[model samples]
Target: MASEPGFLPRDGLDRLIEALRRDGREVIGPRVRDGAIVYAPIAAAADLPAGVRDAQSPGAYALHAVSPDERLFAWANGPQALKPLVFVPHELLWSSRNDGADGPQFTAAEPAARPTAVIGVRACDLAALALQDRHFLREPYPDPAYRARRDALFLVAVHCTHQADTCFCASTGDGPEAESGFDLALHEIDDGFIVAAGSDAGAAVLAGLDLAAADQARMDEARAGVEAAAAAQSRSLPSRDLRPTLLERLESPQWDAVAERCLSCGNCTAVCPTCFCNAEVNEATIDGRENGHYRQWDSCFTSGHSYLHGIVIRSETRARYRQWLTHKLAHWHDQYGRSGCVGCGRCISWCPVGIDLTAEVAALAGEGTA
Candidate 1:
């Protein structure tokens, strides 16, 4: 791909935000909230986290201050993602009522309002969302709800200068730098930012912004910085041929050992960006005259998730746990041409049991069983 011109400085960002606001679009980005960087609506430049960083660990998170005074883009990934802002956790599909003599009347529920731009999206999250795009929006049977949310929103992906111990985007070939699927990509370079357009919508936003043309030297320097940060990743998985190994070791003994510590809480799948399994439930009136059906997020770890004619496929916690991990790292490639995991490590961070997928995979592979 040819290199595109970059943004000038902080002034260009202001102009872009103003443009979005003028269009009556809600401009959401990273903002400091109770010491953590979170995605929320921004009214001005001052709302962004100027110079602060977050401390992340498995089941622990905290925020701290950074030195640079004018640097507005000096924060890491937040606990919250752009998923809920787009795909609502719960929604009323439809409802009906009875008028006695007139019989039953149905009312169609309106879809979620289209959101505008989502700024400061980390590269890993963007890659995970790309995987979801293939599953929900680009598949043979497309989800209208997901399609509407995906098509209407704008994306602003940010390069991660620092990686947490839990992060393994490098292992998955997903992150540390924004590659594509972004409307605009921002890399923090000193006191300013190096912005690149990734789509036509991004170009349009850039055209209206007050950014100066990025020279060859500046662009090259910015690209080099991004590459260096990505190269400096401290954690990674040896997953080049993981799928075949995992497939061969489906009945491996390593699974039983790991399952001993697993609570089967489904926290891993809930926090995972690409795990999109859902289940439908019908709500009916006491008289059974009116009812509404709805679908909600589901997890393979849950016993009901694998329910087949009232009998669960994997009744044991060990089997259910093994099924999820193996499918994510192994079989997902056969189905989607890519591993289901983006190596974001949210699963590691949020799991109450502190079960590490990387450690499990490494142990299995080392035993010559995976």
Candidate 2:
């Protein structure tokens, strides 16, 4: 069911923060970190990256100062996504201890989950979160840890009124505006924010703010803001029906061509919002008195990802690149009923060599091969 929309004044931002914190939820939002906008725990409205914008391009990102009146979410996105909140980068599965007389004992090391409110979540990342829910929660053997975190998650999604050169969420059907799956969807406007609740909990939060009711004109401005961003995008995926084309082009020359420039550094997967590959390892002390089994993030681009008893199937960079692209664009739909790439363009912006996957796919599909 849909909840009513309201208008929150710029100063009223603190009221929302206090409301969530009062509910014992840790508020996470965007902030400047290491020269870029990254998500972190925020204590108050002042912690948000106000008047800060980002300039992004293939293999480059720079932060610039904007006037205070500029939108708070004037930047596109950062390397961090909603993935880390649900699927932790590193998780302890269990631990073994050597008892003095009892021989050995094993104990499960489950992660402690806190009720979390994530502010300033982008539309593209909202889609990624839903996709990950399908992979980790809806599956037959649902991930308990992911479920715990997901259940406690309260999404405060923001519409994209500003886009980077690399973003293509418009083409991917992910967003410039969110349709669902958020507790609250916000559209930042001059002097305030247009906010709508997606669930009862969000409505409860909104009720506490005592915000003014949103009129048609305010709603129109919010819609126009999101639409303007969609039209401004300069990059897009080649097609909506890209699966068959990508599946057939697995043996194309483009893979080898791109592989030559690829460093196999795993930057694409590392920054990808939808990529969820992981590897399990056992960490033990030097004396072997205690050992912990953990699952950590892994990438398909790595040479050892396909390693077997004595041989690696994808030893060559070309093969590994092909596997990664094919799995991401084509095979993922068969497994998850959706494309793995959300068109967030993190792969394009963060690639060390500026290798653009959309360009590669377009070339392989015989459209603008140049």
Candidate 3:
């Protein structure tokens, strides 16, 4: 986390975790759990998923151990990202109680969130976080709860040294190497990590580690790994803006083909970091004196999402799939000035049926329609 890049030896990483905990930040990082790299509370460098390489493809993900190595942060990404840290999956909005005889009193529920530092944040997630910020922190009515959690978050990115077959962040201009939005960033090499600070807080943390300046050879080693990761990626979305391509092909038969295979289980939206749809619920007490109002994550594929006045506008999976793709690649540009997809490929890997969007896009555009 230094202004000039520094070498953080493997053991030094342990101290870095300590430094964050000392700063009263909850240290969250990648951990090997439940057969996937998931974000959990990490106390030391050993908590990282070491020597574990992940294989990712359409509808498949597996983590294999290649031990006798000291490398940590060797995997691309897991099913988790920075989304849940700030934009909570479930949250309480407010509650109303009739303690008085005259009128019921309403109280706004403030979220209790501690200062948190997350490690191993990838470029795609960072890009997704920016889009989330634009949506949640927009003018006129900013989300108070999301803003509070976001402000207390500290990001530590890891430059990708490995690319999954499903990854296309390189072509999306979001990854393989992070361009911005992290407090600190790291490039993993044989000896250790080459660390750099992108913010004052990151610099302060680096100052406590007593790291040495990264030499040219070590720096180049880390840089080369990242470059190679980019070169190895095979999947990429269409180069042009997908908005025009998709909007013009509203009647494309590809939608029906994809829908036939799609389960409409909402796995894609659930894993997508940029999806922000939520459903509100009000539960009234038995006596009717109090009511609990809550909001939780929802997906566009859900029938309730399109249900209005006893009608489901997008009742069919074909319509729902088209809506999701169009909004993610087209309408999002109108709202956030960019595409919603960060090209992390979570949708592809997590989809139970292996519906690759890249191939679907090409089909709809008539580039390679079968």
Local distance difference test, each candidate: 0.77, 0.88, 0.89
Which wins on lDDT, candidate 1 or candidate 2? Answer: 2
Report the lDDT of model 3 for residue 16: 79
Residue runs of model 1 more than 4 Å from their true location after superposition: 1-3, 34-36, 68-70, 284-290, 367-370
Residues forming the 10-long window of minimal summed lDDT in candidate 3: 68-77
Model 2 lDDT per residue over 81-179, tens place: 999999999999899999679977999877579999999999899999888988998757898888999999999999999999999999999988888
TM-score of every prediction relative to native: 0.89, 0.97, 0.97
What local lDDT does model 1 show for residue 48? 83
User: Model 2: what TM-score?
Assistant: 0.97
Ranking by lDDT: 3, 2, 1
Report the lDDT tens digits of candidate 3 across residue range 1-370: 3378889887678887888899899999998889999999998887788889999989999999999465788788888888998888888899999977779999999767799999999999999999999999999999999999999999999999888989999878999898899988998888888889999999998877878999999988988998999999998887636888999999988999999999999999989989988899998999999998998999999999999999999999999999999999999989888889999999999999999988898898877752
RMSD of 2: 1.2
Scored by lDDT, model 2 comes in at: 0.88
How many clashes in each candidate? 0, 0, 0
For candidate 1, write residues 1-370 as lDDT tens digits: 2346665676556776787677667889888787567788998877788767666666666777676475675445666676666555666677887768998889876665655888789888898888787777765778777777787788888888767668888778888887888988887766467777898778877776756777767677677876766676565677744887787888888888978888989888887888877887879989978878677888899999988998999999899888898888888888788888887888877778777778788877884232
RMSD of each: 2.8, 1.2, 1.5
